[model samples]
Target: MGRIAVIGAGMGAMAAAARLAVAGHRVVVYERAATYGGAVRRFERDGFTFDTGPGLLPLPAVYRDLFVKTGKEPLEACVELVQVDPSSRHVFAEGTEVDLPNASRAGVVTALDEALGAGAGARWGDFLVRAREAWDRTRRPLLEEPLWPNWSVLAEREPYPSVPHKKLLRTRRATTLAEVGAWELRDPRLTALLESHALAHGLDPRVAPASAAVLPYMEHAFGTWYVRGGIRELARAVYERCVARRVEFVFGAEVTGIVEKDGRATGVELADGEVADADFVVAGVAPGALDTLVPGTALRGGDEIAPQRGAPSRLTVLLALRGGRPEGVAHRTVVHAADRTEELDRLFGERPGFSSSPTVTVSRPDDPALAPGAEHEAVTLSVTVPSGLSVSEADVEGVLGVAERAIPGLRDRLLWHEVRTPADFAEETAADGGAVPAPALAAADGGLLHASNTTRMPGLFVVGGWAHPGGGLPHAGMSGALVSGLIVEGPQFRGSQ
Candidate 1:
């Protein structure tokens, strides 16, 4: 069996390690942090537990596949996921509330009809059908594969050559979420609501690709879920599974370099001066960090990792409220700006260090595990801000002011708050610039310059949000599985051929 060294213990690292271990390869994971789950981690303060990261889990099947492959059932390990009834509630500046239901094609149309206006539902339905068509067409060909410099491999798998290629190419040029929504929905409110999901990715709606509209379809079709205890529980489950499979975990061990010989990965050198050798190495760290590993030489010789510009990071504030749940609010609430264009102009155009009227997500208050009794409520507020910008004391105060305006009595409700800036995220995750790297093709340059293309590196592979499929827990986990399959299947295919 081939010995493997996996760097980073995020979802990507965990998934890769677990899969390889079960496949009979001896696997060792080196994580910089004391705990697992990289960005999807939880932090506790004053008896209040905050998720501190990703608040929603959509696409349960992806996780189910992981559990099944690892010889365990997801439901048996995790709590039964209760799909958020109204998937999300959008609050406009005019105080109008639009509740999007977790429903089917027709049901979603009806919901949109009721929320937006007459005939708007039909338009939404039509848009969704097209989005679903895109989903069906692209699921296997584009999403499932390792999208690197080679377009021929993806092109050969496309069901319809011309249409898929055009659509895929169009995604590269899209700049904002609003531009994408415009191609589908006519209602302004519906458009805004549809554009909100892009915000989760730290993207502007106005220039985001039309293909992004498929995200809502994926959410509605697969449904959004929350783990009973907390999202971190899912990470813990994966970590335990890795342990059961005898995947050696080395926490607080930061990998500072990737050793190369004859233009191929040999092993890794830790920051603490320990060297671990392996047959293959999968990097679950940031793409920008790769420069520290191998420095400017593409494993594939001609291919390179591109640097994307204009992708923003987030400013997150976790508040430990003094009391129980506030009246008339769901688990998730999005407060839209009174003047969105102006606000976005300041946020994206001026490249503000902070945000105004940012989206806020409040987890379930009934969970006593997170807070003792009902006296305290844990809520998290996340605002998209430009990457590389610092959150000064004034910037933090400014964000607090916006939070007060968005939520009634927000200042009074909070017992205390912990603030995390992009700089903080950068320092915490060790990602270069503290910003999640987007495909340069998807961002400013509209060229495939900035993205971690794993195939470009022979024995060295990358997974998670930094890699081709993009961020989010689902995609991150999927990327891990894909890399594992590549390692496990690569030899078998070669032998067969």
Candidate 2:
């Protein structure tokens, strides 16, 4: 077995480390931070705890298989995973509310019908059927398999199977996600629901390809979940698993550069002027950091899809409230912006800020572990904001004004709040412009896809949110699997076994 050098102890890096160590390799992880769990960091103050990144887990099966493959215990045996009932509650403009149940197709349809009115449920359900086709068409190629050599085929092709519509004498098919909402769903509230899914991932719905509909379909299919304490617990479990496999970890050890010899990666240079040599090197840092790691070595593929940079990130407000979470409150509630057009324009356009009425996702997990007792509650409000801009108290106040709809008298129930912004993300994950990476989206000539795990450099590879398959928890987990498979199986490796 050979030695491997893993950079940044993020989820992806750790996932790969555990697997490679179990495969009889000496894997050492170097994290710049003093502790593990990169962006999956947790916050604790006044006996209240909150997850600063990725509050919920989707498509957990990816992690499940990982634990089973590497050890005798499954993921559930290590971490407390609880399914979030009423997957989400959407509070749309025009005072419409819909509570979509956990992984129940009929329940979602019924909820939509009750909230959006007659035929709305059937329409949304039918749209999901089409979205299912898109999921099936791209799942194997996009998620399960590595970025193929003929990746341009996925770029040039749109696998959404959009429904055709007739406007006047001409016939057209929905090409963009916005078109899918306006032409197919055809309701203002439903449009908001559909667009919100894309917006949550920092993708502008107006321009996001119709294939993006798969985003919502994924949530509806897999359901949302919460760890008993916080989502960060999942990261802790993975880290422990890596430790159990004897993967060496050196915290606060900043890797300054990759030592290359004869066009192949041979080791990494530490900021302290020390060098750690390895047979293979894996990087989990942002694109900018990756460049700094191994200067003059190009990692971008021939497909022209640069790793997404300066993308929108999240603004999280951790609130400690004076009262307990009431029964029947959904775990998650999306308070839709009153005017989405203006919101999108402000965040993605030249404004370099968020809308006065921005969409806010409020998470109120009923887990007692988060609060000191039943007398108080811990709440988190997340809003998608421009990565390059700075957020102010006024911007957060605007969000709370809308959030009042979900939790009436939110101001009265107020407790002190702590804010986490893109600047914080920059320090935590070294992401460029404080932008958080989204999952690798299909379409647009593969313009949004991430670089392959196996880079042009012979002994260097990329993994984590910044790598192939892209940013969300499950996607990042999958990226680790792909990198490990490639390193272990050699150049002929196609995908995970």
Candidate 3:
């Protein structure tokens, strides 16, 4: 049995630890923080709780598969996974609102048509059909398998089948997500709806590849889910699973460097100057941190995909409200900005800053565990912001203003609110500029692809949001699976069968 030393206790690292332990390897996880679940954190106050990280889970089958492979107990046995119906409600700037049903294409189409106009829903439905084609084309290469050696093939060729649009007496196809919205969806409200998905991932729809259509497609195909307590519960379950598999975790023991001998990673150097010897090293950290650990050794070949950098982060506001969450309210609501162009320009333009009318997502879960009682409610408002921006009071107020559209009298209803800036994210995840990683897409000239899990260094692998398959809850889990597969099965490993 090989001895494995994991550099972080994040979900991806923990996932790998559990699988490796079950495979009879002695795995030791060293986490800088006192707790696990890197970005998936929780906040508690006055009997109220809030998930400071991702509020929803898409493609829960990833976790279910993780549990089934690592142990006999199913994921459902460990946590209450509830499928959120009426998946989301969209409140457009023009005051048009639509409630989309969960995983029901017909329902979503019908609702969009009823709310926007006669033909809007059909346009979106047709777009979804095309998006499905994109998903089917790239699902295996992008998510289920390790990033291929010739990843440029996936990067250079756009998987999304864009409809031909004739303009200026010439035929053209949508290339970017913004083009997809403008050419295919047609309706302004529908365009807003389309781009909102990209915005939620900290992606600039104006520049994100057309292949990013897979983002919304994944949600529509699998459905959106909520853990009864909060997303942090999923982290707890994963950590517990690691312990159950006999994986050892050393909390608050920060790793200082990677010990190398004879040109191979042999162990890790802790902050206390103690070296923990192991046969293999799995680093679940951001690209910048990884470089500091290995020092002068180049982790990737010049021809390999370079590590992605400069991704945008998020600004979240947790609201503890006074009134009971009204029945029939959609669990999630997206409030579109008054000016899409202005918001996009502010967020992704050369000088990134907060938008006065930034697009905001408001999540009001019905779970009682999040609040003191039925008489009170807990809500979270999140918006995409440029990474490392110094936040001010005006920025927070602007976000609250946008959220007012989702919750009437939001200011009055809000008993107290706490803001989490990108700075907080930096401290929590150790990522440069508190930047959040987006899921890897199939196109965009390789701009969206992450670094490969298997690096140039032997006996060393990368996992988590910063590595192959990219970020998001499901992608992180898949990263863990891919790393374990590569380590256990060696160079012949092609991913899970």
lDDT string, candidate 3, 81-117, tens digits: 9999889999999898999999999999899889988
Which residue pairs show backbone clashes in model 3? none
lDDT of 2 by residue, 1-497 (tens): 99999999999999899989989999999999998988999999988999999999999999998898789999999999999999999998888888999999999999898888999999899999999999999898789898888888888788898889999999999989999999999998899999999999999988888999899999988989898899899999999999999999999999999999999999899999999999999999898899888777457655545666668988999999999999999999999998998999998886667798989999999899998889999999999999856888898888888889999978998888999989998899999767888787778778678888877789999999877888899988898888888899988888865
Would you estimate the TM-scores of all the predictions? 0.87, 0.99, 0.99
Give the C-alpha miss distance for residue 284 in model 2, angstroms.
Answer: 0.5
Cα deviation in Å at residue 211, candidate 1? 0.8
CA RMSD of all predictions: 4.7, 1.0, 0.9
What C-alpha lDDT do the candidate models reach, one value each?
0.69, 0.89, 0.92
Q: In terms of TM-score, how similar is model 1 to the real structure?
A: 0.87
Q: Which residue pairs clash within candidate 2?
A: none
Error of model 1, residue 316, in angstroms = 1.0
Task: Show where candidate 3 strays beyond 4 Å.
Answer: none
Best by lDDT: 3
- Against the correct fold, how does model 3 do in TM-score? 0.99
